[model samples]
Target: MTSPQLENHLPFLRKTGGAWELIVDNKPYLILGAELHNSSMSSARHMESVWGKLRAMNINTVLGNVTWEDIERDEGVFDFTELDRVLVAARSSGLRMILLWFGSFKNGSSSYVPGWVKTNTRRFPRAQIRDEHGSLTLSDSISIFHSECVMADIKAFTELQRHLANFDRQRTVLMVQVQNEVGLLGDSRDRSLQAKKQFNSAVPNDLVRFLSSQFNNLQEDAKEKLGRFQDTLSLCHPSDQRSWEDWFGSSVYTDELFMAYHYATYVESIAAAGKRAYDIPLFTNAWLPKPAVGGGLGNLIAAGGALPGSYPSGGPISNVIDIWHWLAPSLDFVAPDIYDADYTATCDTYKRGGRPLFIPEQRRDAHGARRLWEAIGSHLALGACPFGVDSLEPESFAYTAQYKLLGSLETLILRSRQDSKRTFGFYFDEFEGQQADKGPPIGVSFKEFDLLISRAFVFGRPSPGCGMIIEIHVGRYLIIGDGFKVEFKSRSATSTFTGILRAEEKSVQNTVTGALRTERVLNGDETRSGKWVNMPSENPDYGDGFIPLLTPAGTRIVEAQVYSIDE
Candidate 1:
């Protein structure tokens, strides 16, 4: 299928059926991505050491940062020397790039802004927060209320985009992140004199109209939060101006909504300007809020806090995501930096409004690495990225093997986007002692049959596994990955029994050509005597006995067809 024509052949996001695909060079592209450390791309020398390792890890895309302070050390003067060098290296290494623009804000602080913006607070203006002593103090983050800060950011970002458009015509840069986890750090809402005055004034007519019109389409959590103000919202007119407290009620959440609107608009100005210079997919990442855990505030604080300021107030958390969506139309989507949050739940939440799901930052451990299956297979994510990969050795990288497998199945995965219901992806993680019961078998219903998928059977203790099942045809499946088994059941009412008819261990003949060759035709032990099809783990334990019912993993691909006996 051909992608829609876009301006300048720039990479864009398109929807196919109920799923989203990232189109590059007139074709659907799957990103096997890894994000570098924040400072890794600041110097070409530092990135030179990292590019070779990323290629070895099977990473197709590199998410790196372009700091305002580094690129524009002096006001109105820009330097793209380091950024250009890094781009050249990445292209030579056969890697795509997603540049994160660290302007005005980085993790709720203005530390990454150029010295001119940082030192001249009177000109750019810093946000103010109430201290513990109830005194208003300056925060490190710039005030979004001031146009000076956003205008400076827009100038720097537009220049960056213009440079990329001219210097790199190959389109090596696939996308750009507008900022890094933006929001206020010390307080729920900015308490500057101007901010106070604006808060007391009537709310924006545009925002009031959005809430009144799109109320039904808002996320469930957002709806719940706004439920109390339903009466006021219903009775309000589009031109009616009311104080923040009077419109949204008296609560800290109202403060969050107020800040979310400003932050979204602040980002919109930069993103919209950058798009005008050179249109490419642009998005921002959010530092998600952590629900209270272990019954203590310490865990909350460590997990980025339960309240707004505790965790970058006014950022695009789920509760305030609708506000960002309404206000930040220039941003392609709002992505989540998932750590210490429910990965699957976060994916579902961000999938609101039919927006694409692309994890910009996540954990680098095995536990975090395994969840990408659900993100891609079930949720139809454009990509999943693990942060801080430059520091890890290629062999030690948890996603190395996963990326290799995914790279091989990239064609099939992308094709499944058109009919995602015929595909499913799942994973089972290693459990603590006696906790294996929690990892129950997954059941999914297809057009013709039902599938019960579980950890690949072993005579000894079972090992953790992850894989995806795609229905190549009715009653037939192509299974990929290690440590999984499938039991098929017929949906027909008259069917008495269902069993595997044929199971073949297969290897990829050519990934580009999408050709497969069967290595072995298995019957008795491998298929559990026709009861199921087993794709054994990398090293299946045999309980130290003579019987060899289980075998070690091979190519980790299997094709199985199931049949039913109708009574």
Candidate 2:
């Protein structure tokens, strides 16, 4: 007989057929999460003032850093005094937490390491990067090759997880990020004497075997990097010795791949130790590649320079993401810390190989807030967190209105996402003049009709817009957010016309029961005389310069039913 349908577990990802949902407290939970400023959580008093502000903005979860230096200042002495206070404050404020471990590396630096570790460079050696003159200079990042450094990090992380498991029976802490934006910054790969020796040695037989066997199935980026060298494993004997330069071309990218192996191994070891202690889901975030400054198509360099050190070498970038996935089996998923890059492309890149999309860090502005809808609606992201959220006031923050609405309708959104094709998220930025530059209107299909959604009709110039749509059933849909409109057209040729039958403004009457009540019936001016449904911008110019007053849409949530007229 089949096993019974499972209920929720403590912060685990549950796969439903093809789609995945984060199960928390016996229900599918959507994290309307915000990440605090990097240094905000260092003090208990600072967190005390921020909790109420976060709740006011309707953020259900907050991602904050838990530094290794602060937790274990004097060698083996682990202290949870400050962390305990932060956790208690979060619990009292009714917010879930995802703690980020700032250890060994944060943006490719060992700045967060304990005072003892920093002082003794011999015991915990720093990574050395080569300069143009071929001389090696020390970077702030710890060397992954150092066993002492790895052991120290592993001990501190294991202790933190153990403490969390015992103290948080309520499981207010949902997930733990292993480290913050880890990788060598100055150079792509470490150029220290020890690193050079390792690089010259034969590539690990296990990695070679895995790469050769899975060559065809690898992600596009990884496949491109491995190129013809991948055939070496199949053509040559396993005992054959092939140095890094022999296996792959002597390029900066090759250096990155080499570093990826070591970094993944180091992170995997730490994550594995933590899992053994507490076994909660663990993830690591990446500082995504910036589009090559002037490099066209194939010549693209993600982090400015052509060498490994230019970007955080060895981080989970697209070129070597597969290596990390294969080597770092202990990590639940790899996330992107997206800022300034092409938003949609970065999201798509991280979601490769059926991995869940989770944005741990992103721009915390209107442009960024608007994109969260797309991340959740289109990508099925577990969460999208805006960086440096503590600095913004609730009333002034761009996410305030959007997050509040999503927070209330989260259950419905989560339920709809199970059927991937039925739900979608979108956003329209302020007009950039060239309409042709903007892509085609978004299209959605129901049995007998298709909906074409575009920027809401404006008498004057259009404004920025963002929102999501869910098809409840054929001919009926739920829409949320503002600054957009949807037009329906009959899919069947036999049907000559299509029109909105009814549009009702909806409000969540009871969140527990998922009961919605109609606050207003929209038609005529509201629905543009049944021509289309409008969810206007929260603040719009009245198109009457004479009147000079902002005309608001008044309501953003709507349920619309459409019908096709047979020819």
Candidate 3:
């Protein structure tokens, strides 16, 4: 299939080499972004209070909401006044936007839908869930099986895109999220009459064909989750009439698969319609499932439960992501709203099939801020945005320092995208007590040698650190950020010893050109007596009143050259 012709002048996603990059003004742009609280963008005046603060935090992009209820309050009526004002305000502040469309569903509920749609249950039916007592009750979410509801969403979303195409002439809005965390909340699959009728019918031939043809290429998590059901794909014919249960086993996972197929198709309709109106990048975000912490409903809601209904039944969690990828052709990608889940694992899963990793939501804390390095440097992510950033002060925001450093190195980072295989990112979180579990030392192999990267060496307790290493040359590396040290070793069998020949602390002399100037010649105590290249913490502990063996972080960047001696 041919790709859609996106407007060249506007911001869009493009695949370069083995990774994806966001192109803005015809250049690779990285999104140093943060998401405002849900209601923060509803009012222009309210957003005014936070735009300057977001800028202060070095956030170039803001993920704000444009709800259905706000845009299409009355039936067939559309209002872009407030949205336009907010867009103008953001542009004035020199910030881009990613508008999240809270249509039909927000956090697995139809609370954001227009009141008319909510009241007219007969026309736009609510999804029904089967309670534990076997009684069917209405869920707060709309049923995806209903065509009227889907049509309404498509119409509203299409109008929104059309308005953006005309109003956002400067391309201030980079992308649009179709819906917020959509899917059934209380049930695995909708139990409404229409939903049940469709559920009991034959599985869609197209979906069957996709699974059959793409089974080998499916993410490992998806393949393993399929279990014995995977065998059915090889045996069953696409034209064969098989019920959902017949094709997949009768379990909660089967219910989830069923919901996923419908949800993806539902989103496909909306996303396709929007793209037809205005061809720009579009995506949806998933409320990721969290580990069960042995608590009840309250805990389950706070920390997403493992089961399907426990977390928005089928909102493109890793296992069902392939269905979304195959079925939702119009969406640029599916993003994960990560909170407590394994951040690296989630990045690896979503980045399958060469999709760009752009985190729409995550924890807004020091711990969460540190993971952005891994997402951008290691995974070659387009960007990552921490959630509810407006709630925190810019002075105290955890992402401020990280974003500042990343923004300074944005030019160099984008230039290295083609050689991402030679780059690595890592982080160490501050431990509560003396016994530090900073994870095992990460080992990275290059063409000439190897590197053992560990927490920055300090005389006292280690502080949190995050950094990335880029192999600018065969034996030379550009180390950025703080609180990390690198130990080089020879990969050749004949070489007996490998050590840092020279290490220089460098500062960004020109942000636009990415020009650097040597700030200090790091050696002796700074490089651990030439044994390793030390990028010490901002405040390195000296332990006792003696000769200071470690220097505090300066420039938070180092250029090191390693040499090996042959036996």
lDDT, model 1: 0.86
Stronger candidate by TM-score (1 vs 2): 1
For residue 537, model 3's alpha carbon misses the true position, in angstroms, by 1.5
Backbone clash count for every predicted candidate, in the order shown: 0, 6, 0
RMSD of every prediction: 2.1, 3.4, 2.1
Per-candidate Cα lDDT values, in order, are 0.86, 0.83, 0.86
Give each model a TM-score. 0.96, 0.93, 0.96
lDDT of 3 by residue, 1-567 (tens): 433434348777888788798888777889999999889989999887888899999999999999999999998999999999999999999999999999988888899999999999999999998776778888889899879989999999999999998999888999999999987787788988898998899988887778877887877767777765677767867778898888887887888999999999999999999999988899999998877442122323445687788788878998899899988999999998888899889999999877888899988998889999999889888888999989899889989999999999999888888555477888888777666576668899987989998888887766788889888989899998888788999899999889888898888899899899998898778887789888888788766636677778877889999999997
Q: How far is candidate 1 from the true structure (C-alpha RMSD, Å)?
A: 2.1
Model 1 spans with C-alpha error above 4 angstroms: 1-7, 234-238, 293-302, 419-421, 544-546
Model 2: number of clashes? Answer: 6
lDDT of 2 by residue, 306-341 (tens): 345666788987778888899998998999888777
| Cα lDDT tens digits for candidate 1, 78-195 | 9999999999999999999999999998898898999999899899998898886778888888888888888889999999999998998988999999999988876788999989
